[model samples]
Target: MEMRSLDRSTLGPENGFSQLLKPWPALNSPFKGAWCVVAPGTSTTRHAHPDYEIFIAMTGEATLSSEGEEITFRQGDIVHFPPHTDHQVINDGAEEFQMYAVWWDQETAGRFLERHDGQDGDRDGQEG
Candidate 1:
């Protein structure tokens, strides 16, 4: 077993967003977790990735835009997006918007998406 501390985590600031405690570029893992801070009145550019991603708001609020829809997410709300799904988060609040963001490889992500998508097939060919 291993233990880590959030206070010792690293901060990466880029393109109007800052990611704290990313496991990569230092540690190795199929999944990575980060505490993302979006500065007030700032926004992230529309982008897509090959990994499944999720964001859970921990403080303040933000507006998420994707697929022609915009939704406001408050503290304690969660958002999930599949691979290659273009999305952007805008911090339009008066305070910094903080959230927990997680990403994993496509294979691991496939399981979650498949289950929710009502797919009956599994990697072992078992029926759900």
Candidate 2:
């Protein structure tokens, strides 16, 4: 991924219940980028990215966990995870959850994303 401003046009729609701003990243571009926002009371299926991911919440709250620690995150909170690590995001709020996720491949990139086709990921619903 190349270095771009916060207003990257290629990033599609906002993700969550609110007007979530993604400004997402490109594939195999040599950079990891943030794909932002998940709706409140909703959640993305548990999963892992090929590059390290960072979750930033600007509004509402979220239930996020890695390993055995489960925590709720609110505004001004930033969560970081390394590649291939398990992570889950759950919107526990009543309103929309606005978030920004920044991913990096070289640990020096503006953003990067490794799409997992439901292979290696956070599977909260598929567990025994």
Candidate 3:
């Protein structure tokens, strides 16, 4: 597996996506897509992955949910989920939120918005 360390500067304030990691630049179809995500104390705008996903929290504590139920994850916790799993997270700890989210495709993102209250999550990062 080809692996590359993502520099910290690569992450910045993003629309909807607080932090982002473009592991797969789309040039390589069927790429192993991965992203670094960070959420503040407040809840993130609900979203989803069009493909299978894996979330790795780098630091701090967070509450992630896929329906009405929420699961709390401390530092070093890893979460594995399937495609179309509508989820959202918030960092409750007194620090910046950080997590690496891995997904398979752009369609997976749409499933996130579908689970929401009919709110379309067609933001910039994924499909428009």
**Best lDDT among the predictions, by candidate number:** 1
Model 1's TM-score against the true structure: 0.68
lDDT by residue for model 1 over 25-79, one digit each (tens)?
3344556677777778888778888988898999898999988899998899999
lDDT of 3 by residue, 51-119 (tens): 677778877787888767799976799987776778777767677666766566555444444534232
Worst 10 residues of 2 by lDDT: 110-119
Output candidate 2 Cα RMSD: 13.6
Clashes of 1: 0
lDDT of 2 by residue, 55-127 (tens): 7788788888777689988899988898898877777777766676766666444322234322234354432
Candidate with more favorable, higher lDDT: 1 or 3: 1
Give all candidates' CA lDDT scores.
Answer: 0.75, 0.61, 0.61
Residue 85's C-alpha lDDT in candidate 2?
A: 82
Q: What lDDT does candidate 1 reach at residue 14?
A: 52
Clashing pairs in 1: none
The estimated TM-scores of all candidates read 0.68, 0.57, 0.59
- Of the two candidates 1 and 2, the one with more favorable TM-score, higher being better, is 1
State the local distance difference test value for candidate 3. Answer: 0.61
